[model samples]
Target: MQHESASAMAGHARQHYQETEQEHISRSQSGFPDFEKDMPSLVNRFSFSLKDNLSSYLGSKNPFYSNVDPQKDYVWLLDNTAYQNRIGRWKAEIVAAYFVKNSGKDLSEVVGYIADKIGMAKDEKVEETIEQRIQPLLDSILPAHAVTIDLQGVDVRLGPSGRDGISTDEIAIPGHGYKDDQVITSQAVKADATTMRTHFASPKGWAVLSDIDDTIKKTLTASPIGILKTTFADEPEPIRGMPELYKHIVQKLDSPPFFYLSASPYNLYPFLRDFRETYYPSGTMILRDASWMNLAGFLSNLTQGTEAYKVDRIEKVHTWFPKRKFICIGDSTQTDPESYGEIYRRHPKWIGAIFIRKVTGVAEMDESTKNDPERFKKAFDDVPRNVWHVFEDPNELYTKVDALVQTAT
Candidate 1:
């Protein structure tokens, strides 16, 4: 019954307004509401009621209407939500005044207006960012180190070394003209470690250093402004299978033997935190510089083209944990291979292995490293055997290292 009555009342009000509008149009054809002269009596009758409803609605939405002392008839229903936004962004005085006057509470008194409006509560949802989420996870395994090896684009042509046709030395045989008196020079040969029987283990005080973009996560080619907006405003999407791997590394491997190294700038902390919260909530992070991108800095990329910022980070890790061995993992698409190779050469005992991700854009590894079992033995130079393995995906490494982590002290 109440719904029916309300419907009837609306219909009657519409009819009355149409009749009044038609009559007003016929008289002057101005199609305007001249409040000062026309409909003075009607205003006197309904103006108070209209003003009251508007004020009531606005007041319930916020406390700003309480301080407004305008005459009941003078009020107009205007949306002030965007006006407040404009006041902060464009600094328009008139728009700001309307928001201030119509709103009872001072704009300055509204704490967490942005977060509140967006429904992002710091304690509940928005607190965990990619950097913060990953930080503790990384910190728990704090002794991480990485080594990237670049093969210097060396060719892997196979066959015997030192041609057979070049004759220089004349030999004097003890038994002249004898059938077994001939002396010949042969090329050096060695066996690959993969075929050799050995007991393997992860060294003490070890951590894993890794590349960021394309190795563990997808790289979004964002500009500086885009990066800033993402860090300070937008959330990030995490890579598949990363959260579980991180948790396993933390809970299984534990702390002081695991860490992360990346070339991404430090300004991306917010995005990092966002990624972590969405996936690995307890992860740890270590970021690089907060400065603008420099073209000159990019020149340090060794083989697979990496950001030069990672070089400093890798060096820093070696300096901080000089005695700790780092099992480095990165993609062939960047300098992970070359840089890690350098690290292995410099500190053989401190670097356990260089695992390269076989990627499309990077240079292909030597065929001998891919095929011959013996050539692999001499490639490590002075480093320990089985310290270099190339993989297509980063996740594959956990399987090989799982035994080491399970038995770790």
Candidate 2:
């Protein structure tokens, strides 16, 4: 875990940033606006004034407040999964995000907004105090472009970040004789820069592709206000029995690699990453790429075009691990069933089992429709009923998971 000094890392990042700025300048001199390089800044500038005014008028430091410091920023390297390619080389996709620290303000304004949206805003000091505790969740994203990060302890060099302040690159690890599920962490070659862990998964074996909202954590995605409360106001709560069920999955599946795929945007990576570390097996989280500027985008990220987004990400995973049998797990609150079904149809043999949680009892949701077997049946149409199971409880999957192991044996 040894890393370069903070000064060294910061210098490297600055060099890259300058080089990228030069390129943007050249492009702009050619008579183009360089919109890709400038739009994020414009949006951030506008949003800052708007949020500041709103916060001032309301006299509250809200979750949506955007106070960015261009001079100070940090890199966040997301956890990734590596696999051995056909040429006997280990390869992994490195994803990183850049951001600046936000003003450490009470996020009670988020709770207040949610309360007002649902007509629940009141003088309940107890509830307000509870929501303020999650203030750490609010971080100002650095809308940086072309920021490069060097790595230590691995053979990977991430490309320059895009307009959204995220960079993704696929690099081949130069070594052999690595253990299966070997965990390798790449530290930033600078001080205080984020480090990422890559799990080396063998080319063949079992892997779990699970969802985040409502599958393992209580996200309440069916209701917009519930979504906001759980995401911004309240502490993340794991669905009952899911932590144990995931542990059982690890034991029965022989500690296979897990991929927690979600439709949530990448800004929530740290928050979701903490939740995963607390209750589930360590896995690479595949999240949406959009770095949204407003609170509305959060809800839209969960509900809009999610089926297509999940399908596309799963396809990328399939490309990386074509031989591995996958167990797909998701909930009924959104498009998990449809997304999983679409992938399963395309590669029937690649997927071994599909589990869909029959989400129910959440406020403001059409529970009867969500829990109806007909919906699952329609969603899984053209797929084998024996291959997919819908359940209300995590305990119901223990024997089913054991059965998959036996079938594989």
Candidate 3:
């Protein structure tokens, strides 16, 4: 009975992975990408088969890939890293990313290890094609806007929606800025895009730059399966006391702009946005490029490249708000501490405080991360202890932030 149960569980997991893959296949067939036309030819298929078989053989022999299982998931995650817009201009530059990802659990990790060992996972990067179309859904929300379409893509130019008769909720970034008088109304709409609008906050005021996974949302990044379950299967759950803390900050700042910066893919933007609207302050979302990889690839990105990715985003934000001081929030799961520290070093005067949520539930970490000291001790060693804080609970964050930003505010 015990053996049977084990087999059943494995089989169920495998089936789920297969079903998910099939669903993606169906979606592609639904005319989104015209996958049939893009399908590889017979010769290409032969070449790919040869490469895949070679990889499988090599992976089976690799000592590090001993746990290769058939039931792993490879997902393509979308990461929207940067969205550049002027304070009162309709023109906006939306920079996004798309890539494959691994479930980072069990067989997925093992396969990722093998894929990396065999050089089959060349970042699993997909090139952007000129024919690919980019569309913004909330154009009607703008009072006056024009889109220039080309074979290459479209550039969205938005003009100011002067406050004459515009409701703040209807415009992406209201000309008047968000005010207590402006309330988000739930109206029946034919397009999901109506819910989305792109606008930048008026600069020069303090803003909060926050991390998504684990810091605000309940992403179990430490566990491979935990990651899959949280990001894929579970309804996004907010970290306890986090919403209240964010509310307090926004209230104190009287509604400063916010930016949710993350390494998570752009595919999750809508998901995270829903959660944000429900519990946190509204702001621009910054995500890294998406990718499809197994667990090994996930770790490779997190360990070898995450710090650079985060630092680059932070620097860009600093460039945009050079004169504005900002609060940085992230979790201790990955390299947030180090990444934020690097940003602080470059712009010491601009970083008001760095908050790292210490993850105590998970015990295991990647070999590279295992060497790092607990919390902000080593990551922000040179920075004043008061400037950066590490805590397990969100309640503790309010006090630490108050100590730092109180006088500045």
Candidate 4:
């Protein structure tokens, strides 16, 4: 009983801290809410009450979303494979983010539609962001030091490896070339352990670090409408042949670890993670925390700080496996060419290859390429010709990664 109270108290404290910090970031970006709570109401209490009552009426009538009362979830768990030496010395860490969503059914879909019509829905949803309420707390039910395999079973606190990352604890594994079929299973999760296997690591410690959008999935990111449809409305679609290419890379590396680094907001973590699991091999997924406004705000969130964001994640991944060589995969639709190029310049010895897809279909990208070829060219000018390749089709990646593996061996 005491433990339960302690856990509950911790949760509230964490939630308060998160809200305060995020509010500061918000103020920096767009300033605080137009009015303070103590200040006189602009619309007055009666006017706000009337609007809420009307919204409730509309929501009750329309039944906008097909499912009205789906189950609410507070815990989201991401599981992936990670790599380390046989003796529990990690070669690379598997990073998984734990996030909670304000139940999807916070208000009826019709309520959201109304909010959208009124230009206030986005703000309302942002306020529902996971960090706004859910706090990290110890699972009081478990004895101290004990944790649960379930993402929500414990209060999760991530470590410093990532801008937001959790540290993996040491798991005992004997010296290898000892076995390939080795696997570990625990009835309950330990304090610092995440779900991953160490036996699948590449023989030479080579890892594939890839981006999620455009390169592997059809984000059509250049189009905000496209981004909305793909990210939220439609099931994610994979880029053709890319899965086969990634699988082939894994096969050739004898099961090298895969790290997916993206600037996609954390809110979409489950959506993207499912796509990766279905199409690509399991690996750690790193994502950023962001709020969803309407479509325009959604697009802005993906691109804001994206270049610097990638650099920071890449540096963090590199830190995890200082001795391993990496093959980076990204698309030219954004600043990937520039970002990867800069990474190569700084850490040429650490990179084995860089692949950037020649992204097309969006009008802005088409115009950018046609209008100024130099922009793309100069992004890679500092990068070595042998280290990077830009291909529109995935087949080219197969041939290149194939060659890279064969020649290295």
Give each model's whole-structure lDDT: 0.35, 0.68, 0.48, 0.52
Q: Taking the tens digit of each residue's C-alpha lDDT, what string does model 2 give over 224-279?
A: 55566677556789999999999999988889999999978786787899899999
| Native-referenced Cα lDDT, model 2 | 0.68
Evaluate model 3: give its lDDT. 0.48
lDDT of candidate 1 over 38-101, digit per residue (tens): 2111111111222332333332232222222232111111011000121122110100011111
lDDT of 4: 0.52
Selected candidate, larger TM-score, 1 vs 4: 4
Regions more than 4 Å wrong, model 4? 1-74, 80-88, 91-111, 114-203, 291-297, 364-366, 370-372, 407-409
Write down the TM-score for model 3. Answer: 0.55
lDDT tens readout by residue for model 4, 1-409: 1121233234334433434232234333332222121221111101112232233223223222121111211223344443554444433332333222232222344234333433455665532432222122110001111123422233333221211112233333323443332444322233333244333453456788889988899876454334444554445689999888888988887677788888775546656767888999877777764322122333444645566678877997765566778898988766677778878888988888988888776653443552245755776777778888778888877777777766453
Better of 2 and 3 by lDDT: 2
**Worst 10-residue stretch by lDDT in candidate 3?**
130-139
Clashes of each: 37, 2, 14, 2
lDDT per residue as tens, model 3, 1-409: 1121232234334433433232233233333233223221111101112233233323213222211112321111111112224544322233321111221123333334333433444344311110011011001111111111111123222211111101111123223344321222221122112223343444455788998877898765454444534544456789898999999887776576788988664445556677888988777787643222112223223233456678887887776667667889987766788888888888888888888877665544442342345535667867877788777778887666566555553
TM-score versus the correct structure, for each prediction: 0.38, 0.76, 0.55, 0.62
Q: Which ten residues in a row have the lowest lDDT in candidate 2?
A: 39-48
